[model samples]
Target: MEFSLILKKINNTLSAEKELIFNDWYSQSETHRQYFKGVLEQFENNRITVDNKKGWERIDQEIRKKNSTKSYWKYAVAAAIVIAVFSLPFTFKNTPSDLPPTTTLEQQATIEIGSDKATLTLEDGSSVVLQKGEHYEAGHIKSNGEQLLYDSTKTTPNVDIAYNILTIPRGGQFFISLSDGTNVWLNSDSKLRYPVAFAENQTRMVELVYGEAYFEVSPSTKHNGSHFTVTTLNQEIDVIGTEFNIKAYKEDPIISTTLVEGKVVVKSSQTFKKLIPGQQSKLDSKTNSIEISKVDVSNEVSWKNGFFSFKNKQLEEIILVLSRWYDVDFKVQNTEAVKIPFNGVFNKKQEIENILKIIENTNEVKFEIKGKTILVE
Candidate 1:
């Protein structure tokens, strides 16, 4: 028997004695440590670890054929021991979907975005046809190829008076520039409202109606009340200068505020919380409560970088995010599957079917993709 098969058998064995011996040898050797490190490095860099392992095994077989006196069982046992030890922790890390049977339910819902085209609604309730262009300014606003820009000069009464609504369709995205020079990257199915210019004495405030957005707040050396504020649903975030991401979809139960830089004070009608970098503030709608916890910043902010990151996120949470990004509906046939958490990452631009295929590879879950609907079982 080969080392891999022997190790797999030992892992599945009900007898504790064999498992203990295998685990001990696995953890006690430096040779095993080097092998495991090599495997991990190959996997992390998107190299083929399984192929490399097979290549090593082929070399071992060739060497053994030349020296019949050498025993391959000896190396197999050594490798088996290490594999047994490392797999113990991993075997216990299965998601809820890997568990026993449970009741199932079917859900049907639709996702809607505020608008489809990239348009600007002026302060006078009129509209401006802003097409894809380079460096164009109307009043105190400007836009590049991908985003709109806002640049305003403070004056005695702040004569510049302009406000507009930027709407992104379900499958559309846009960029915007705030009067304070803050840059915003709005995801699909998102809407943002901002003034054309900052008020002379008022603070800068923007409202997010739905979906996700990343903000890089520009510093303000002038304007005593130069703070940046973002309002979503019933919660408000105040920041002096910071980089942050907010997911405040109306349909989702929890509103998330993940701080990337500086500080933000998230205030509700009756509660408030301060968050630092790498911290995520979660607000629950049902109870009107807020909770803060340290999170993996890269995992939370990866979407802004055009990556989908799932750090053991519940299947329900993953569905919510997908629903927003893909502008689709989720239909789960098994309620028990909601408890399952997935840990994975892929480019945001990848096809939804590709992402679902990766999830199905786990073997504990299956998916049915039909048009804009995803059915998980």
Candidate 2:
């Protein structure tokens, strides 16, 4: 198969006959399979924008210069795949030499990456601080360090509903398994209010007071057709055995509900919309409007996967996300710095300094850490 045709096949743009031919070619040699794997990795890591002709020309020149005397067709093919897949043209200017030396001054102490921490408010208004790596049992609810789970062994009849709130502070995350077996993953600076034991034959309801959460609803069949509902500030999501993510931070202008699987109905006071898999319903808080759009479900739920996936996100927006995860304050010295757009994925487990370094390496802005505050310029 021609190298270009292989690229087309890799991209799923080839006919069935060509795909079969490409698969046969790949199976003939381990070198072909390895080359294909490398190409796939490059395509995932870098966003290639150059035209096909230019990409091939650049690859041909590089191969000729590096392996002129070799008769290695595999080497040539690998080189072409790498060049075609990973050629990102970065034009950002380097960091200015005249800028002040970056320093890490003491603000308080360096805040660590967010861990499993939360405050569980009981039905009596008293609270329990859930520490990392510690297990506790409160009534029918049991917590195993990272997650709070309701014991299924205990059964509750029709009774007055009692609610408890799990509040995750800045630089903290937590998980909870409701009495109905539904699971919720709460992000930093968030709160989930749910019943300790849901009443029999009643709707399983929870409220995301603020921030973000990813929910995996238990099948209604298991609960005698009891529906699941998530209440946010401006919208309500009705689910039936669905997995979805909701971002309704009070600081954000919109409440976004992205469905991963099954179905969800997003309802505001004015209107309602149903969402299928890979679709998102965004409710505008200001206008009280609901809009539906197709989205990359994985990107929307990347926080639950321990990464920050930014797609053309503004510097200020990125700062807000980082601030919550790192428990730091941000002060942008240059006004234009907040307007700068960034697009990339970064590990959420990294230290605040290391994460800032990745942004600084772009050379669009620099960062200085003063205690717990990050000054961006």
Supply candidate 2's per-residue lDDT for 338: 80
lDDT, candidate 2, 1-377, per-residue tens: 45456557657898988888888988974334644564455455553334444443454565566764232232333332333232222221323352223344333356888889999999999998897878898668878778898876444666778889999999999999887778899999999998878888888888999999999888889988989999988888888888888999988999999887787889999999999887888899998899999876656776886667665578799899999999889988978878866656555765666556545533457787777877886
Q: Point out the worst 10-residue segment of candidate 1 by lDDT.
A: 76-85
lDDT of 1: 0.64
**Which candidate wins on TM-score?**
2
Q: Please give the range of 10 consecutive residues that has the lowest summed lDDT in model 2.
A: 83-92
Residue 350's lDDT within candidate 2 is 59
**Stretches > 4 Å off in candidate 1:** 1-117, 127-139, 152-161, 222-225
Q: Give TM-scores for every candidate, taking all chains together and pairing residue i with residue i.
A: 0.66, 0.74
Model 2 lDDT, full chain set: 0.74
Query: Can you write out model 1's per-residue Cα lDDT over 183-300, one digit (the tens) per residue?
Result: 8888777788888777777778889988788888876555575788999988999988888889887678899999877888999987999998879999997787999999877667
Candidate 2 clash pair list: 107-371
